[model samples]
Target: MYVGEMGIDRPRELPWQELVLGGTAVAVLLGLHLLPDSGGVDPVYELLSEYPLRSVVVGVPYTLALLSANTAVVLLGVAMVRQGLLRGWLTTTLLAVWCLSLLGLTVFLKDPVGSAGTWYGTAHKLCTVANFVSLPALCALLWRRFRTVSGWRGNARRVGVLAALSMVCAVPFAAAFLRYGGQLRATGTVLGLIERCIVVLDIATIVTLAAWSRAMAAARDKRRFDHEVI
Candidate 1:
């Protein structure tokens, strides 16, 4: 149902939260990747988990990684509020859990890439699994909300669905490729490439959501303009 139908007041302009959050995130990641002693190009290809623990191990890069990741997830939480998708306590709680999952992966880094037996390594794996699993669940919950918003229909709908599906398949695809293709080692390998692709796909979904929100905000402004002019 429309926000108006529910007697809710809609915002006049698009929320700039996503732009700030996502842009800062991309910049931090790029900056970290470009730092000196960052193993040059070798570290770039390896899984990101290998970076703070195994490779580089620089404090600035490590901290920035966590900050950027958690900040970006704020956009996901605010997206619903800006779009007037807030339903009740259930929606709010789920979104909180989803955001926490994203943040959990940043806690303390891992026990290096090879030593999953360590306490920190175990925590890292749990967080990683939570992040991957919770992502699709968030998308699923947002499905109905997406359809309710007129701006998210048509091509935007297809884009959103495809993006979510890509995320849903990413972990499995990476796991299978790692198991059958070869060992999951540093960069320049199939596993590393697949993992990078998954990151790209995740960013794509975020961008798509931002675009949809902008469209909705624009449409709302135009409607209000017409009403005023009339």
Candidate 2:
């Protein structure tokens, strides 16, 4: 079936791979918080980037998590293109930018909390902003595209919810950062918690889309087999 220029047929099934990649990302992210020597950083006010700046133990896992998450997103984007869930060069460009921004995170370490600004830190901040903005925008576009498709309506709803939740958390996160001029500790806000929530939701969105694509592909294959047998 075709919806405008988007094709929704014969989706490829690769949910397990995506799950493995995304799961690794989430697991490492969660594990960072439990590290005994995590800089004595306050999870409520400090950002996840603080861990690497404080402890070498956290840095390796943090880099691994970002790499894993980036791979998962790249795979998901390819699947979306194959399944016709994403259309147009504009969306494709956005996805590429998002993936590159994610990769930048791994390459450029964030500025240490309350440290003098450096060139790498500035680049990292730009990448962070681009990563944050692009994913939600992509999700919004996907939700609009998927809602009308027969097999994708449910996935559309799931994407919508995840995107909405991430955006909701982002408002307070941004507000606190701005209100304190990026001094989150002085703002006394749960910036870390809020950022964590957004990351979790974004990961969930990727997994949900992967699972939905797998299910739809399976259903399509079964129907084709049954027709051939008959």
My TM-score estimates for the predictions, one after another, are 0.68, 0.81
Candidate topping TM-score: 2
Model 1 lDDT, residue 30, Cα: 68
Q: CA RMSD for every model? A: 5.8, 5.3
Relative to the true structure, how large is the alpha-carbon lDDT of every model? 0.57, 0.73
Q: How does candidate 2 score on lDDT?
A: 0.73
- Write candidate 2's Cα lDDT for 31-79 as tens digits: 7777674445667778777666766767778888888988988988898
Model 1: weakest 10-residue lDDT segment is 179-188
True-vs-predicted CA distance for residue 135, candidate 2, Å:
1.6
